[model samples]
Target: MAKLIALNKPFGVICQFSGDNNTLSDYVDIPNIYPAGRLDKDSEGLVILTDDGKLQNLISNPKYNKTKTYVVQVEGEISDDVASSLQKGVQLKDGNTKPARVKIIEEPSWLWVRTPPIRIRKNIPTSWIEISISEGKNRQIRRMTASVGFPTLRLIRTKIDKWHLGDITSGSYVTL
Candidate 1:
């Protein structure tokens, strides 16, 4: 049977096992396990790992169209126009992204505080939004939010397909 692990990746930790900075090895002791999908160093939340190559491919491959959902805190209040623009797909430097499911949401009460926390602008208000996309383009969420003039202040991946961050604490992993 394939071994699966769900991790709540902490901010500032690299996705790989070894590097100059904090990596999965610091949190995960499992041997031969590889992350199925990647969360950037500044991003937090669910990262699924597996020992099976096929399973990893299934989850990470864009062709599979597995939905990845994020709770994003942006620099300013999200306007209806911004939400509509994101839902319609924003043109990025790489190209236009596929349409995404976007909606304003309250900041989740279950969120953990990030170390070296995001900068707060006393004059600027922040708002949260839930964004679900099938394509995992590099820094796609951040770019999408920036394109709409919101600029993400914090980003957390809350779900990937059927798996979720749920109660998994940061820097922790659960065998599934």
Candidate 2:
């Protein structure tokens, strides 16, 4: 089996194992290794690629409860009640989600900016939060924040299980 490689995929890049399509080919240059799970093209973060099917399944499967952490910037100041709701689990369109580890945080000193800046208003305040969830649902963080009133401005994955993005800038990849 090929060795596992951890990649910090930048925004606008697709989570494709192969570069058969023009879109995938244009962004990534890795060969052979396949993505264990996927990050949406617009979401930037840590992604794992490996040839071990069992390891891939363990990380991607919801039943394993492998923790995934994200540093999200939202449009407005997050209320304590909203933070409580996020920790307790908010009702989403799909269903009520699993309770997650959520906390408001200051901007990390090492985080890099996205290629296109998030829309901002001079008068409205914004806040950052770190959220860790066991389930890797589709756009779950976006929906979770929106449900409680503050919509996400930027969402970046900082850690997955024991692996972390750790001081890596956007568009940079480190093999681990």
Candidate 3:
């Protein structure tokens, strides 16, 4: 039988199974399972792992259009115009992204304090926004925020399609 696991990948952990830095293998002792999709080393949150190749494609492939939700903490207070701009799909170097669902949200209480923490400026205020995008582009969220004048200070994936980060603790996995 195929096994599916959701791992809460922490900041600084490499997405690959093997490397000099902290890698999936450090936390996952399972055999043959690979990450369905990847998160950048600086980004943290839910990573789905599976031994089934077909299942992996279904989750990772942009064609499937799985809705991936991210909670982002950006450097400045988000304006209504910026929120609208993101929802309308901002153009990138690759091209215009698909329209995304975006809204300003309060900092989630469930959010864990990041180790090494994000830098803070005394005068600048930060805002939280929830963004859900169906397309999985390389560093898409980070790029999008940067293009709109507010750079993302921190980002966390809270959900991927039907699967979610849920009550899973950082650096741990929940088998589903």
Best by lDDT: 3
TM-score winner between candidates 2 and 3? 3
Q: Tens digits of per-residue lDDT for model 3 on 1-176?
A: 89999999999999989887699999999999999999999999999999999999999999999999999999999998999999999999999999999999999999998998999999999999999999988999999999999999999998999999999999999999
Q: How accurate is candidate 3 locally (lDDT)?
A: 0.95
Candidate 1's C-alpha runs over 4 A off are none
Q: List the candidate numbers ranked by lDDT, top first.
A: 3, 1, 2
Report how far off residue 135 is in candidate 2 (Å). Answer: 0.6
Worst 10 residues of 1 by lDDT: 18-27
Clashing pairs in 3: none
lDDT of 1 at 154: 94
The models' CA-based lDDT, in order, is 0.95, 0.82, 0.95
Off by over 4 Å in 3: none
